[model samples]
Target: MAINLVKGQKIDLTKGRSSLSSIMVGLGWDPVETKKSGGFLSGLLGGGGGGADIDCDASVIMLDENGKLKGKENLIYFGNKKSKDGSVVHSGDNLTGEGEGDDETINVDLKRISPSIHRLVFVVNIYNARQKKQDFGMIQNAFIRLVDNQSKEELVHYNLTENYAGKMSLIPGELYRQGNEWKFSAVGEGTMDADIGSIANKYA
Candidate 1:
């Protein structure tokens, strides 16, 4: 059975696996039917956008052992869809979370990631949450998971439920180096940052 993680939980992705090289990190969600379904958070974070489609964007911020950003190109998202060294790649933007399955994916070649890099933080934010006054309270079934892309084996996954109401951004989880092996953590953290740029500054 696949490991189902709760908030603050952690798991080892390379525990028994010898070759856990390529991984596909996925983030998904469904737009809220109406702000009324959530509550006060909807009032606090909703806008006069008049129920337009929500555009949530998924991104990755690569940090060194010191928690400092490695470089600009390391911020993978819609515009800069791929990392400079070609180790990490984003599958482009997902304007609306209308379809099934993951809305966005970050394909990582752990073997090709820079030796200096020690952590990869997975983040998600509504494309224009600030302008639209939207938040995670307006999204449903939001989750982040890591899978061995080659074997199609799911290593770990976490789904955000009712806790992220007023937040516009989420730090769902992270993949970091533990000794010579790698591990995944279920962070499931919500933030007030309205855009990806602001969230990116935290690591910069």
Candidate 2:
């Protein structure tokens, strides 16, 4: 069974489980539905009339021991699907959050991560949100989860239930190293950061 987490909660990832080397981080969301005939959902369903379909892009930032970015190649997203070291890989962008399950996923190899890397921050942002007039408030049922890659067993899950009105970016969760072990934390925080570059600049 997976442990459902609340905001600010943290759990051990590879402490007791010596065999846990790789894991998958999944993020998902859906566009808010409206009663009107044509809207975002309609656009996604192939009908036309609503505002443009929401394009939410999921990304990961790999930080060093100081919790800061050391290189540009450490950022993983649709354009850059994998880390230079191959420790982290992204599943690519999801133009519409119309799916039933995870819209995007990032795979992490614990043993392959460099010793200097200490944190993996999972984030999601609206593509061209400022122009498309989209935000998290327009999205619903957003969640992030961690799963055992080999066993395909979910380990931790967090549902972001807060109202992120006018927020273009979300920091769903993070994985950080403590000594030689890794842990997961449910961040569930929202920000107005426009794009991945602006968000990464904060740590750079």
Candidate 3:
């Protein structure tokens, strides 16, 4: 089961084995360039003729009890890196305008993780293309959500729409146990031209 988490809650991860069922990590932003093919010359010059586009990847890292990167083999991925037979562990990249399915999902097998695992770290990266110059101008409405497996409840929702000038690190807040449920929330928002490590020092 998953426990509901608010702004400032805590959970003791040393006890039960609450596996992660599903994760929805989303990146939303307004396109600074939205013109989509003005002319061949504009394209050649690399001007603002291309339409709005967002290319990014999201990742979640599970940490051991001592807050270290120990076991990563059990980490799951969705979008563009699911499985060989197309099982869709990680969802495909969403290149269109930001919308409902503009996010990636990663499913984890809780049974594989050690009971001492204490925290989860999420990282997002913006891909750079030839035609488009990556911009960190204005990113809005980005967050991470943890959902329960059995009960299908929204365990935690982390808001990361603030602090645009610098990278944000979201420490899990409001994690606790309610009967058989355990959950937490840690959301952050930011704009970057390259990888997720450019912002969060932890990833670097």
TM, every model: 0.91, 0.92, 0.55
Q: Which residue pairs show backbone clashes in model 1?
A: none
Residue range 1-204, candidate 3, lDDT tens digits: 444444444544324543553334343344334434566434432465544565655555555555555433323333235422221145555554366533655554344334655555555655653234443332345555655445555555555545443332223232222334544544343443355344333432
Per-model lDDT: 0.84, 0.90, 0.44
Alpha-carbon deviation at 55 in model 3, angstroms: 0.8
Query: Which portions of model 2 miss their true places by more than 4 Å?
Result: 37-51
lDDT of 2: 0.90
Higher-scoring candidate on lDDT, 2 or 3: 2
lDDT of 1: 0.84
Poorly placed runs, candidate 1 (over 4 Å): 35-51
Candidate 3's clash total is: 13
Candidate No. with top lDDT: 2
Candidate 3 minimal-lDDT segment of 10 residues: 168-177
Clashes of 2: 0
Model 1 CA lDDT for position 95: 89
Reference-based TM-score, model 2? 0.92
